[model samples]
Target: MASPQKTSRKAAGTRAAIRRARPASGRAHSGDAGDDIGLDALVGHAGYAVRRFQLWIFQDFIKTLATVDIRPTQYAVKNVIGANPGLSQMAVAKRLGIERARLVHLLDSLEERDFVSRIPSTIDRRSHALHLTTRGKAALAQFKRLAAEHERHVAEKIGKANREQLLRILACFT
Candidate 1:
């Protein structure tokens, strides 16, 4: 009987022969065997593919926002302030999943742009309430329209049904 090593080598040789007998390609196919993992296996952990797709979507969004001179995070901040007037900075930070310090910086930029104002809360001097200035509101309205257009474009690319399912899945993750 053949040694186990010999048998394994023979089997591998037979497989290689069979592969070589098939059509030859112009592409060079030299690589370590471990490098040939399937896409699903490579990006399937914890929905890595989904995360990658989200990144692509965000890239498109950032490009769109660039035209309007607004960043995606900035739009998010403005929208939250628009929806929740008198919202506390801490509350905004908590709801938006932004760190308190980062939120402060974001608020500072908005304030500098005259897009938002921080007024002292009537109930607490330490906590400031947030409000959108008229300019801010107008800017938000424009952002909303642009966002709607971009959303529709993305939805068309991903299909309406898949878009709904994606939103549901993302909500569950968050």
Candidate 2:
């Protein structure tokens, strides 16, 4: 992985943009005290490192999902429905860190594709309970396989121990 972008200080209370450079040898180099570490120190700022890593992982996800005709959010909603049949739309939205209103559009698209169904919530007439259709179940299985491949690729890039530690530390922020 590349080092974090250059880090600078514009003011006492603000941070400057982080910048990174690649060596001619094609190796990643994090900044050290002797080097102009600035804000670009990959080891110095966890957030910067994580942001770059997230973009890397997302790119991998996009590549792996290209053949599926479904967005990551759509797959996640379906996965949630598969795991918790009859879950309320609001609950799915909350679990996915998305707005309930946004979820409605996603649900509509899925329903149109016959991947899922929305039934009236037994607990609340005004609410909806989500369920995956047979097609959606099959799609989820395929997605799981793709996800496993994605994870394996990432693990290979960042060692398994580092990957596990990274996930554990990231969960703390959430």
- The top-ranked prediction according to lDDT is 1
**How many pairs of residues collide in each model?**
0, 6
lDDT of candidate model 2 versus the reference: 0.79
Q: Per-residue alpha-carbon lDDT of model 1 for 1-174, expressed as tens digits?
A: 999999999999976654553324423345735334334333325667668777877887877777777877889889999999999999988888999999999999999999999999999999999999999999999999988877987898899999998788789645
RMSD of each: 10.6, 9.7
Q: Which 10-residue span in candidate 2 carries the lowest summed lDDT?
A: 8-17
In candidate 2, stretches whose alpha carbon ends up further than 4 angstroms from where it belongs are 1-43
List lDDT for all candidates, in order: 0.82, 0.79
Sliding window of 10 residues with minimal summed lDDT for model 1 = 35-44
Clashing pairs in 1: none
Distance from true position, residue 16, model 1, in Å?
20
Off by over 4 Å in 1: 1-40
